[model samples]
Target: MSTTSQLAKRFREVLLDGLWIANTNFKDQLSNVNMEQATAKIGSLNSIAMLTFHIDYYIAGLSNVFEGGKLEIRDQYSFDLPPLESEEQWENLKSKLWKDAEKFAALLEQMPDSKMNEGFVDEKYGTYLRNIDGMIEHCYYHLGQITLIKKLLKQKESV
Candidate 1:
């Protein structure tokens, strides 16, 4: 497979399905989470919902760039998750994440392998391959956090 295709596959593995790396994808982990559990606090760490919004924020922003939009996402606003007071709101957030993830993967798959060496957005941002790889790594990092938070939440429930 081409590099772009491989990258897309890896992206899907983390956000959608496939279990080669963490043994659990975002879909799997979030499927079991309700609004209460998602928003529950585990010490001072970010809630699962906050982490989900943060990851989706970057994915959607980059996907916009892939679709010829301007790079407008900022780190400061990435965690600005709106109040998820209801189950519907929580579901909507997850729905957006899944939709954005699929779109991001599709766009990545369609990208020319030659463009992988081209700088992403600007020369200072480094190459498309680097950004794509960085996103995958970032997802894994937060995925680990979400998994641990879920465990802690479950433990709290049991007690």
Candidate 2:
């Protein structure tokens, strides 16, 4: 394979890995907690469900762009949940996330390395790679947040 194809393959792999890490990290934290506990905020940041939603928020934006849509943000969906209030709501939000992740992975698969430098600018992130690699890097950074929160939750649970 050409170097470009190799890069794209690695990028897609990382992108998929980020989604898995985010999902697993969050689930690990919320595992022991019941609906009542999961609903509680982890401080001023957001609840576990909200953080998970935020991770989905990023992936969803990438999906919109890959599909030739524009985005101010993904949570603009009429029923977006910033903070799910119940177990049923969290599970539903998670289900939507799974669908988004699957579609996003397919987008990654179709991407051509030639498009990596295509160039995109947003008021928020500014000019960027216009490639899956950059998006994967961004996703993993947020997944790290999930890991941190999960660690704290585990510590608390044991105490």
Candidate 3:
């Protein structure tokens, strides 16, 4: 593979690793909990459900940009993905996020060199590279939140 291709592949791998951590640590648990339960605070943050949404949402958003599209966000968006209307809704998005992530990763992996450096630009960030960088960082950032959420969930379960 070419250097650019290699870079994109590695980037996909990083995001995939994030996907595994997110899905295993949180999304899989959504089936067992209600919306309120999923959004329930362990302490400081909202809950695993919301964090999961934020993670998946941004991955999809950035992936779309890499795929030659863009989505509008308010003030750089936030890390917290809110709860759905009900447990059922949350369960649905839970599944959709996984599928969306897989598709996102695949599209990003195909990104060509010419396009990787190109994307909707903002004065603050400038270039798709920086935004993509932010997207990657965002994943790991929430993985930290997910780790804490998982620990809390385990504690709750054991008690």
Question: What are the per-residue Cα lDDT tens digits for candidate 3 across 45-112?
Answer: 75777777777777677666656665654534655465467767787867776677667656755666
Clashes of each: 0, 0, 0
lDDT of 3 at 144: 69
How much lDDT does each candidate structure score?
0.96, 0.59, 0.62
lDDT of 1 at 11: 98
Candidate order, lDDT descending: 1, 3, 2
Candidate 2 vs 3: which has more lDDT: 3
Q: What is the lDDT of residue 134 in candidate 2?
A: 63
Model 3, residue 3: displacement in angstroms?
5.2
In candidate 2, which residue ranges exceed 4 Å CA deviation? 1-34, 74-80, 121-131
Output candidate 1 Cα RMSD.
0.6
Pairs that collide in candidate 3 are none
Model 2 whole-model lDDT (C-alpha atoms): 0.59
TM-score of 3: 0.69
- Look at candidate 2 and tell me the lDDT of residue 159: 95
Shift of residue 77 alpha carbon in model 2, Å: 10
The stretch of ten residues in a row with the least summed lDDT in candidate 2 is 12-21
